[model samples]
Target chain A: MSLQDILTTGTAPKRVAAGMGFWKSLFSALDTPVAAPSSVPADDPLAGYGPQAVEITPAIAANQRLILSTRRDIDLQELEALCDAVGWSRRPVRKVRRALDNSFLVVSLWEQLAQQRRLIGFARATSDHAFNATIWDVVINPSFQGQGLGRVLMEYVIAQLQQAEIPNITLFADPHVVDFYRRLGFVLDPEGIKGMFWYPS
Target chain B: MSLQDILTTGTAPKRVAAGMGFWKSLFSALDTPVAAPSSVPADDPLAGYGPQAVEITPAIAANQRLILSTRRDIDLQELEALCDAVGWSRRPVRKVRRALDNSFLVVSLWEQLAQQRRLIGFARATSDHAFNATIWDVVINPSFQGQGLGRVLMEYVIAQLQQAEIPNITLFADPHVVDFYRRLGFVLDPEGIKGMFWYPS
Candidate 1:
């Protein structure tokens, strides 16, 4: 297929299904080339769209449970609210949704009340899954700042990547937070690895 | 599932399959949820494996067509050899393979000869597929370095991402190539976006 066809129609060429096929193929490739299950079992949770959330339980506050989830089907409204609480510029919900879907890994943090759960922080990473991963959109709700939820979020994300055997983990920080990342053992442009970006004209 | 289960078993909870399911779910989430087709139709290119490559036809040299493919099933040996040609440290083939499988986008460049295609240059990006993308492992074979194939590869990768509507693109480069990326409109920490990384202790 022509490059134009890819851009215009968004018809990914053969084997290029970005979501389900992509993830399954990756796992299969990681372990071995497994045959596609002739059919997903009727009771399999994975039979549905997104995988189930894996909640990370860590004590964050008294009388409240702090939890983190790898849920990709995050509620867009809750995420937007978290971003708003941090005073970040508003991004279109549609685009935000697309970003989450495209992300290799997404970690969402929440404060669980007696009856409800609130999204208090969010982070994501995209990776080549071999050499490097770059994280983006790390934010904690203003009310939850200074409680160390941000640190907890980052640590969990980093641990997960490391466990998966990903070698390098990176994130772009604002001037104010450069020291914060450093305290977490993140060195800036370590060994002279300079960061670069490209913006649309 | 408990975080321990996630770490130990690697059985991603509900929707966490990193390969096919992850990708399909993301796409469905991006557009709108669609019913999983009951069964794969025979002859569907996507039904079996990775997507086909899309060729960009711009002349790099006469007779020897410089081709870029989005095809993810790249030969790890060729990639390792290209890295060797450029004097990069050796990486395990398995890890390199996983990295490509996990990447959001992978661009492999080839020099088409009368007899066969030779792997010449390579680059990949990991993206949230919405807000940001980070380019990685950008390299050109020493034999092909001066002809500007590296620039062509970066431009095409950036353009595809921009067309997909992602807002930010990033990469970490050695000091030597920082200026090369700048000429392509990438700035160093534009507006104070400092890049940071964490390595295993």
Candidate 2:
């Protein structure tokens, strides 16, 4: 298939999966109303689940082992490896470092799926930190595919921002993922935000 | 004249004046062949030599002021003020704030022109902070008109950046100010950087 077909047509399966996952989670919650836990254990590996889960700090040191084991922030030593992962043109390490440092927030979600602490999924946000937030870099590592980790990560991040009382959050979903976000309470902003990108040649 | 006519005909000289002040300050060093100063005291009172100085920070306590000032940070309040000053409509402050915090290095320049610290000018840059910096938001106050302070400020900032040994510093200038930047060693970018603005009511 052509690139346009891949972007527009082949995305249906992912959308169906995301939609079914949203409904299943919603109905499952209604079916079993669990009591809200007062607090989560600091070291509880499963503390990220259910209501009343403890806060996840953004500090790398707080979760350094998880970060390192998941290989989330790998050094971009090779151009081909970097491009294969991010579809970005290869540039100097200095440039890549600068871009990574400038990212507003980079969130990595780890899950022990099939007996491995895998980088199930991740997302990056670009924002001014007070009022506006843009979600980007939503990806699921291929090894950890077919689980509901993407949705879990999304919901977790959304809850984090909501708890912080942030009012306006925005993101540009790949057209295929638009329906996924919509189902998760994001509306199709008719007058959506525009962004400009310049690549080093 | 209508507002559109005024803007198109360039009759609102005050707006132009503020813009010119910023442009002048940023490029002052290039006007003369003399080697520029190595650095200026961040609290240099002479920095506010132009017309529209706004003292966002106190001059006496330079170090403390830098700590307290959100000028370098993505400030929602100041972003609102900027939109108002430029006649743009309001937007979700969070998004703008994020963009500022993540992608831009904002520098707040102030001056004490009349025994009051006023924010006479400001500049934001998209840079690796090592190479390939693009400068934006060089503005000066209109009330503090006719002083050569604007040029001085520009020259000072550029010299500091140049001293860092980064090559390929760039900026986008309005048509009228193209020659101004040109004289300061910035050539016209034939493949201009993409720029867009959104105004929400």
- Among all windows of 10 consecutive residues in model 2 chain A, the one with the lowest summed lDDT is A23-32
Count of clashing residue pairs in every prediction: 28, 29
Off by over 4 Å in 2: A1-104, A111-115, A142-148, A174-176, A187-193, A197-201, B1-104, B108-117, B120-201
For model 1 chain B, where is the 10-residue window of minimal lDDT? B21-30
Least accurate 10 contiguous residues by lDDT in model 1 chain A: A21-30
Best by lDDT: 1
Residue A106 of model 1, lDDT score: 87
lDDT of 2 by residue, B1-201 (tens): 332243234333221112332332212221233223345456543332332222222232334221111245434675566446655568776556555664445555554334554454555555444444556556555543344444544544454455444454555455655565555555442343222221121
Candidate 1 achieves a global lDDT of 0.65
Task: Give the runs in model 1 whose Cα sits over 4 Å from its true position.
Answer: A1-62, B1-62
DockQ of each: 0.32, 0.10
Q: Across residues A1-201, which tens digit of lDDT does each residue of candidate 2 receive?
A: 222232233331211112323312211111123344546456654444333222222212323222211112534453224244645445677765654565545555554432344444566544445544455556666543444545655654554444334455655455566666665666553343222222212
- In candidate 2 the C-alpha lDDT for residue A83 amounts to 46
